[model samples]
Target: MEAAPAVLTFSPSSSSPAGPRPCRVLAGPAPRRARALAAPHPPRAVASSRAPLVVSSPPPPPAASGTPATTPAHAKVDRSGRFCSPRAARELALMISYAACLEGADVVRLFDRRISARREPGYVFDKACLLSYNHMSFGGGPLEVGTEEEAEKLTSQNEMDSANEAEVLSAPPKLVYNSFVLRLTRELLVAVASGWNKHVDILDKIIPQTWKDEPVARILELCILHIAMAEMTSKGTPHKVVINEAVDLAKRFCDGGAPRVINGCLRTFVKDHVDNTGTSQAAESKA
Candidate 1:
């Protein structure tokens, strides 16, 4: 049989968030066998289409009752060979939001500048802006940053102090690079801000009851879930991919047993959403 066309692959280093991630430029097409190694974010293929058709989101469902939710068997796979993760985008967003709360900096402008500096893939940048803007809109303030926020503020002040006073005052900040990512990011920010509460309520329904009792205690966990909901509801990402991403984020960042909590809650959330929206056939077909 003729081989599938080869595509260049660049896998990001899972260890270093800031350091330059090594790129592996493979020459041959990937071997097609029983799938084992899988992509982290599987919706990249759908997102890659130049003129993508997004599934319009259904009206937000009412908050949960005691119904048991089922977990999906397998994660959906998007074979686009993307190296970007939503983690960087999320971290940048949180950082910008915290900076806004601490120093009153312009969050949008700061985020735009950071995007240029980071030089992330277009999809990753787009997802991060969408997730962060949605999270910011829902809370209407900076996420709880604790010592991290303080540390960031101190660093900024120190840099400003070290700069030549005349140079700092006279030199205008360089113009932001108007990349496709920036344009999409701005568009997402505005749209999410406009219907903030609507999206927030949708996510609130998806959160587990245990977490719901003391939402403040698990702020970051809830924040990640909110991002996943925004992706599933508005972006038309597969439910399995959304849940897997949420579970993976919890395992990476949240405390022990966090994966179970996130997975269970998201599974139930997906079940409820699918049932209400009558998208089981669509979801299953993807699986």
Candidate 2:
């Protein structure tokens, strides 16, 4: 007998496998949403089941197309063929922090003809005190607040050099503690008080932590330890060892100014420390 007019039928997949049986449909175009489905009635079966309620998911949202977001750029000093180590980055930041504090002392030196002609670097204590708010530092306010009273106190001390060693002004009064090593420089202390506020912002933007664990806080601690070591070692005359130690320490801990700073701080510190000791030893020791 001739085959009865064949009704449209769907067949199971040819490669032998166990799965849901096939469904047959008249050959025609899939409906709008049906175009996405593996088979026509699967969702209907799921909906019918008393065992659990189920629903088919809609398609995912498309991604937005555009330029990517801006991010902070860190300066990486190359170490041989490779990028700097985390230790190096930390050192660099610390050096920057140190300089930023004192660089304010050169607030006058920082500018040249363009600015100098306009006005003398203001001698106003407001400018110095304002550096307690270094644009680049970790902290915002100067560790030493720059109130009129504070400035007057420091100015008075500077004038009274002959009365007593105690009376000699040690530092301008507005100077505060270094956030990292906590000794003191009139310039540096102001810088640090400024840095204490700015540090977080700087690290967050440019210096990503070396690891999840090795954060800026750790770098700061290491810097402090190295500075402390430099201070203790500089007690001897010559201070070359003091400078060396400072450099070595900065390399291991801080991120920026290991070399030049070691030189400056050692020279100044040796002169002060030795002179205070009232020793002729400095000349011989330096030689």
Best-matching candidate per lDDT: 1
* Model 1 misplaced stretches (Cα beyond 4 Å): 1-110, 113-195, 274-287
lDDT of candidate model 1 versus the reference: 0.38
lDDT of 1 by residue, 1-287 (tens): 97553322222222245642322111111111100011111111111112322211111233379866532112111132111234323332333332322333334554455555643265122211121111111101122223544444433432332232222111211221123323443433333232234434555666566655554445445545545554555555667876876676554445556668778877776776555442433345556
Candidate 2 ranges with C-alpha deviation above 4 Å: 1-238, 276-287
Q: Which digits, one per residue and each the tens of the lDDT, describe model 2 over residues 56-159? A: 22112224578564221222223221123332222333443323222222211221211223333653222222222111111111123235454444334322
Error of 1 at 214 (Å): 3.0
lDDT of 1 at 174: 20
Q: What is the number of residue pairs that collide in model 2?
A: 28
C-alpha displacement of 22 in model 1, angstroms? 41
lDDT of each: 0.38, 0.29
Q: How many backbone clashes does candidate 1 have?
A: 0
